[model samples]
Target: MMTIRRRKTRKRRSPQKKRSRRRRSTKRGSQVKRRRRQAMTHRKKRRVKRRKKEIQTRRKRTLKEKVKLLVINLKMILLLKLKKELRVPQKTRQLQKNQPQKSQQLKNLPLLSQLPKNLPLKQTRFQQQKLRPTKSKPLFLLAKPRPQHRLQPQ
Candidate 1:
């Protein structure tokens, strides 16, 4: 019985409005009217072009993307700084070790001088002269000893 009453209520509702299907016609008016219509269409086209340019500029980058890029750049800079900070102590330690070794070698020179003195005097003089010529050779050719026959005077 309730279903029957609901169906009756639905039937009693007002009919929906219907749209007209007739084709609308534009007026073929005076030459002045035609010119005015053409001008309006041109203005509309220009406005649409301007709107498209604005949309393109807005699409290039939103504020959120700009912030993300800034964050990434900051992170990279911080990482580079951290790497430099970590390397500094190691470099200082290496310099400290090398300084002591150089000083100790210089101090031991007088004590270890006996072995060098026993070596042939002419042999040591020849070695010193050879070192002067070797400095003039190209770096790549230094791995192999130069031929004795090709020795040239400066």
Candidate 2:
């Protein structure tokens, strides 16, 4: 009988893989290094949050500015159209020259340009006051007290 040799199986150790800077700094690092890394990450996260808020505010402001510009452009276009329509032909100009009374009447008519810039478009304070009841007290407060019924027959 040939002597049987027993083969021993050994486990192979894998090569050490290099850890990333972040992982090394945070995980396997000393307490001070990990704390520093955590602080830095916290600061970066705060900066990112602040930047996002600022960007959002900028976007809102830009939207409002765009709307204001659009309103201004619309007003300008309306003024241009009004100017075009107001242009008088030579024949109409001659006719208007003959009618001074009509021109005076037109001048007296209340136009948007003639109105005060700060004038309220809604109902005036005086008009609004008229809509309210004239009485100072409410209806419930002014109601006459009913005679107390006798709880027990005297």
Candidate 3:
């Protein structure tokens, strides 16, 4: 009666099945490790690229700054040369002003002056020539000729 009342038994798993399950778990762990390694390599490559870009940018900026400095230096040199030219003329004018009274009087004389301020008191050679009229025949006649093709069509 005890045997008749016994519950149905279930089969036990084999050692080979347990071993295969363990192998599958290890394979999955190795796959996870491979993925982690791939991610690390990708990150390293990106970092190297970013660093190279940063270096390139720095080089370009430095080159631009050098060019700008060169232009500024050139401008400063030009300005210095212009200032020297202007100063020489100013100094010459000052030296002329410092001369004695006799030279100043000579410079102020009407006949000796290179620049004229107003109309002359006496008639010049040009004015005398203009005032005298010459007796000569006219070079051209005041007349127009009729066009030969005036009646032609356009």
Tens-place lDDT digits, model 1, residues 3-45: 4544445444334422433344755556679899999999999
**Pairs in clash, predicted candidate 3:** none
For each candidate, what is the lDDT?
A: 0.63, 0.68, 0.68
lDDT of 2 by residue, 6-124 (tens): 89797654455334223644444487798999999999999999999999999999999999999999999999988876886778878977877855755665555644444333555
lDDT of 2 at 93: 76
Global lDDT of model 2: 0.68
Measured on C-alpha atoms, candidate 3 has an lDDT of: 0.68
Ranking by lDDT: 3, 2, 1
**TM-score per candidate:** 0.33, 0.39, 0.43
Residues forming the 10-long window of minimal summed lDDT in candidate 1: 112-121
Q: Could you give me the TM-score of model 1 versus the true structure? A: 0.33
Q: Model 2, stretches more than 4 Å misplaced?
A: 1-29, 89-154
Which should have the higher TM-score, number 1 or number 2? 2
